[model samples]
Target: PLLKIANDMVVDLPTPSNISAWWNFGSLLGLCLVAQILTGLFLAMHYTSDISTAFSSVLIFLHETGSNNPIGLNSNTDKISFHSYFSYKHLVGFAVLLTALTALALFSPNLLGDPDNFTPANPLVTPAHIKP
Candidate 1:
């Protein structure tokens, strides 16, 4: 299949050929950005960006992944058309995320808040070094 039916990215990868180094760089940069975006999306699926947890999560992610949180091994194989399948998936994903966040906030308003917002981060204490 041309796109593996939108399931797999095996065919989607840009194969290097007789292109110039500069052209290759453009492809490389695009690939990097796509990978970065996908990585970010996967993280956002699990992590929330609220006050109290944000600082800890940011520090932990930096320390553990060295701020390079990966999207893991290539595994989207069966392939569908990106225009039809992925575009819809993107919109649905965003909708689901927003719906979930709205529900959570409505049901548990205090869960997403930062208790220490007024205090601010202390320069003397490094959150990355603090014990949980």
Candidate 2:
């Protein structure tokens, strides 16, 4: 039964021609997916799924200084700021991730399927529904 399904897959059929090196985007995409999954897992370890703690946990993970306290006469005045760190890193990471995803989408339009799959979200409503 599985073999029949595999045999019937017209989309999975490969051409007799050799694929160009440019076609390696699929492999690169797989690598990116792996990286995202691993990073996501690491993030999940520190993340709080509950609405009350979710934002705070993300802030702490992204912003908390990983140890670099100033030691001097005015040491009390110096405090580690997670806001700066988190904002910068988050922005950079998001930009890179979006760029990579966009490039993949461009390279392989069939990757995500038809236009019906592309749906816009109502951010305000999504959070309300996700809240526990």
Best candidate, lDDT-wise?
1
Each candidate structure's TM-score, on Cα atoms with residue i matched to residue i, is 0.25, 0.26
Name the runs in model 2 displaced over 4 angstroms: 1-78, 114-132
* Candidate 2 local Cα displacement, residue 62, angstroms: 24
Query: How many clashes in each candidate?
Result: 13, 1
Error of 2 at 19 (Å): 71
Candidate lDDT scores, in order, read 0.62, 0.59
Question: For residues 73-109, could you state the per-residue lDDT of candidate 1 as single tens digits?
Answer: 3345633336888889999999999999999989988
lDDT of 1 at 125: 75
Q: Model 2, range 22-107, lDDT digits (tens) per residue?
A: 34225665345446556665676656456548778777865664344435333645665588889999999999999999998888
After the best TM-score superposition of candidate 2, give how far the Cα of residue 73 lies from its true spot, in angstroms.
19
